[model samples]
Target: GEAGRAAALEGLERKVKAAMRSTTLNRLAPDLEALVRAETIAVQAGPRPSADESVLAEIRGAVLAGRPLSFIYSRPGAEARSRSVAPCGVMFGRANYLVAADRESGRIQTFRLDRMTSVEAGDGLATPPADFDLAAFASQSFGIYQDEIEDVVLRVTPQGATEARGWRWHPTQTLEDQPDGSVVVRFRASGMRELAWHLFSWGEQVTIEAPQRLKAVMAGELAAAGRALSRAQS
Candidate 1:
């Protein structure tokens, strides 16, 4: 199984290298020229989020040039507003986000690429803080949206311990085997809403032991589901 996965990764890497050689991709990411020429393997799961190619090109160019960006960002149920930020980096997961710092507040924020309009690069140069590490910043959250970080603990029943042991929950997660044959999973992260969404799939196999916020979020989801089922029955 491990060998098959390795082969698949290698094949994907070859395909990516081939794709990066295209005129369009090369133009969009000239900084990646050296990277594409190097040997590397990368594999990702889940559906890739889609965004405007022109918007992505603009962001990439700004990031490469260490320039600030101006755009109009709109969130659901909120009025669109203009924003100016120094481009830090872009993170691609189930959704693509521009992780940038607010020009006025100097506070870091994430804006979905799909939600941005009228994207323009600023004239003045800007860059991330000297101590800023993209990987470290990304690891602070369970998902893309960052909030208050909390110590999360999950207890997996004996029936699910085997599966849990093999799963990588988070980069900072540690697994502890219990005398009762169960497993305790612990990590520090944010994005309780996303965590609650994932825990729904586990049914009763997993139980949250800390972070009242996550427990409350899970309860709220359960109550909402109950209400929806009641409405359906009527």
Candidate 2:
């Protein structure tokens, strides 16, 4: 049984190595490495103070036992704050372990593992609601933004479409070919800021459809640029 497990792992590694030979995966490999290195460096080259392993172990135990935790957390650019939350799940985001918490407001919150300064297990909090669905919660989410969901449709010109032919933007994305030698891509996203910026980078080759608001935002940006050019000429 042990030998069989080792062979299975080696087979999986080979498949991963084969997949990484593709262009998109190859480009992302370095960024993934950097993220891991950054997390390791933080843990290794820390100041005299280090995170308490006992606290971490207790937090893990609480999560497994469906208990709550109160901890001091500091946002990337904000002051440190105290929070009381019920532990739900732990997920790996890039190289960080994100702890999902059920807040007092009945909404779920995610906290970065490295940003937690102090953690303490608390008295038993209510377990996740009977109807709580983790898969649906993350279905339309792009990265961590989960405010509102929008139907985004993009028309990419032939050249741009060719560039995106085999790329996977999201699991639910649908790509269709249009008669005018352009490609139409449609997907539902909870956050559009990242996708909007990505489409904007394609310059005039991509057009935003369906959501008039996105087009309006792009038009305003172009108008501002025109005004800036006019001011410079004068």
Q: Which candidate is the best by TM-score?
A: 1
Model 2 regions more than 4 Å off = 1-59, 95-101, 200-203, 212-234
Candidate 2 lowest-lDDT run of ten: 42-51
Candidate 2 yields a Cα-based lDDT of: 0.69
lDDT of 1 by residue, 49-79 (tens): 6556678778889999999899999999999
Say which candidate scores most in lDDT.
1
- Residues 96-212, model 2: lDDT tens digits: 334454565677766766678668777766466556666666667655556567787888898888876677777688999988889998888765654655566689888888677
Cα deviation of 66, candidate 1, in Å: 1.9
**Clashing residue pairs in candidate 2 (N, C-alpha, C atoms within 3 angstroms):** none
> Which ten residues in a row are the worst by lDDT in model 1?
1-10
